[model samples]
Target: MKQAVIFAGASVQPEQQPPVPAADLYVCADAGVKLAQALGVVPDWIVGDFDSLGSVPEGENVEPFSPMKDDTDILLAAKYALSKGCRRLVFYGALGGRLDHTVANLQMLRFLADHGAQGVLVDHAHWVTLQRGGTAVYPRRDGMYFSLFAMTEQCEDVTLEGVAYPLCHGKFSNAFPLGVSNEILAENAVVTVGRGDLLVVYARD
Candidate 1:
């Protein structure tokens, strides 16, 4: 499965500027093109309306979508990546600025996960995702915290390991904040969910 990295035009912290080499297919969403270029990584494909791309890059592989289109720029980029056989997408600069856009991007993860694709939203302080029924592991980083929120009705049979507080077959709901502020203990921490959708967020203090 080919991996695709997408850059979105959101407020990014300085620590998040340098491009990380995790995906072969790189995509820039509108203004994200400039951000990627500034990071010294030219995108293999640039997709979005021209509104944010201010100045275009002189090259092929740059496809422009209608500015007045129904889909958002980030969604367009994700769709294009999927069309190009990308199985996993790592989105950078997806958080910050408008709360509406941040929530929209979070919902997009559900779409990707439902369609047999794995999508992760990366920002300066958080890593967010909708964990369906699977096990997710995070390599330990000192002073980092991990959180899990059940976005749906209930996340049943959830388990957590290598954390300050552990759970065994626990059920979580959107109305409750039971899974907040858990710290990583071991070299790696594991989270497993049996049913419902969960939004797992990892952050550093």
Candidate 2:
């Protein structure tokens, strides 16, 4: 499986830019082309409605969409990457801007998950993703916090291990943030969800 790195239009400080990962494909969505230029990465594909970008970019790979379309720019980029056979996607500038766009990007994680692909939103201080009904392993990071929340109404038979507060066969609901701000105590922390979905976050303090 190949990997794709997508640049989104969300605002991120210079200090908040994470190290760009190597990818088989690089995508820029709308104003994300600016971020890509700042990061010194030339995009393999550029796509968007050109609203945030102000105008269509000059490139043969640039794909333009109708501004009235339902999909967000980042969504269009993600779909383009998927069509190119990239299974693992890493998105930069996908969070921290308008609240609605941030929420919509989170839903994109679910969209990737449902399609048997892995997608993550990353910034300098955090990594966020969604997990379906399955087990996931996370390695401990010094001075970082691990948190999770039920994306569905409830996540059943959720088990957590190697964390500051561990749980076994527990139920987590979206109404309460029971899994917030936990520390990883072991080399690897494990999370298992028997049903529903989880929004997992790893944040730097």
Candidate 3:
């Protein structure tokens, strides 16, 4: 299974890139081409309306999509990545933009997850996801914090381990802040959910 990374046109903070495993393909979405170039990484494919791309990279791999297309640039990039046989797609610069775009990107998580692709949105201070049924683990960092927010109407049978506050088979609702500001206690923290999707945000304090 090939791994792919997609970059979107959002404000990226310093030290936002993690040590991601080298991807078979790197995709740039619209202005994201400039972001990739600034980072000195040439993407395998670039897809977007090109309105935001000031100078197109000198390559045939750059494919321009219509600005009036129904899908967002990032979403188009995700589809391209999947078409290239990528089983996992990691996203960068996916947050801190227009609030509508950010929320739309979050919804894209469910789209990818439903299609059997593992999608993660990494930003300056946090890694966010709307995860379905699964067991997620967070490796320990010196001063990292993990928070989970219920994205759907409710998340059932949720559990948290190795944290300042722990939960077991608990239910979380979208209207409350029941799972906010939890700290890690062990080298690796774990969260398990039996049903419903969770919006998890992990950050460094």
Off by over 4 Å in 3: 13-16, 54-58
Q: Residue-wise lDDT of candidate 1 within 1-205, one digit each (tens)?
A: 8999998888676456434766879999888886786677778898888686676666788887777888889999999999888989998878885799899998898889878888888766777777888788877766568888988889999999988899999999989999999988988888899998889887776
Q: What is the lDDT of candidate 2?
A: 0.93
What would the TM-score be for candidate 2 when compared with the true structure? 0.97
Clashing pairs in 2: none
lDDT of each: 0.84, 0.93, 0.83
On lDDT, the leading prediction is 2
My TM-score estimates for the predictions, one after another, are: 0.92, 0.97, 0.92
Question: In angstroms, how far off is 43's CA in candidate 1?
Answer: 0.7
lDDT of 1: 0.84
lDDT of 2 by residue, 89-195 (tens): 99999988899999999889999987788999998888998889889999998878999999999999999999999999999999999999998999999999999
| Candidate 2 local Cα displacement, residue 63, angstroms | 0.5
Ranking by lDDT: 2, 1, 3
Residue pairs with backbone atoms closer than 3 Å in model 3 (clashes):
none
What is the Cα root-mean-square deviation between model 1 and the actual structure? 1.8
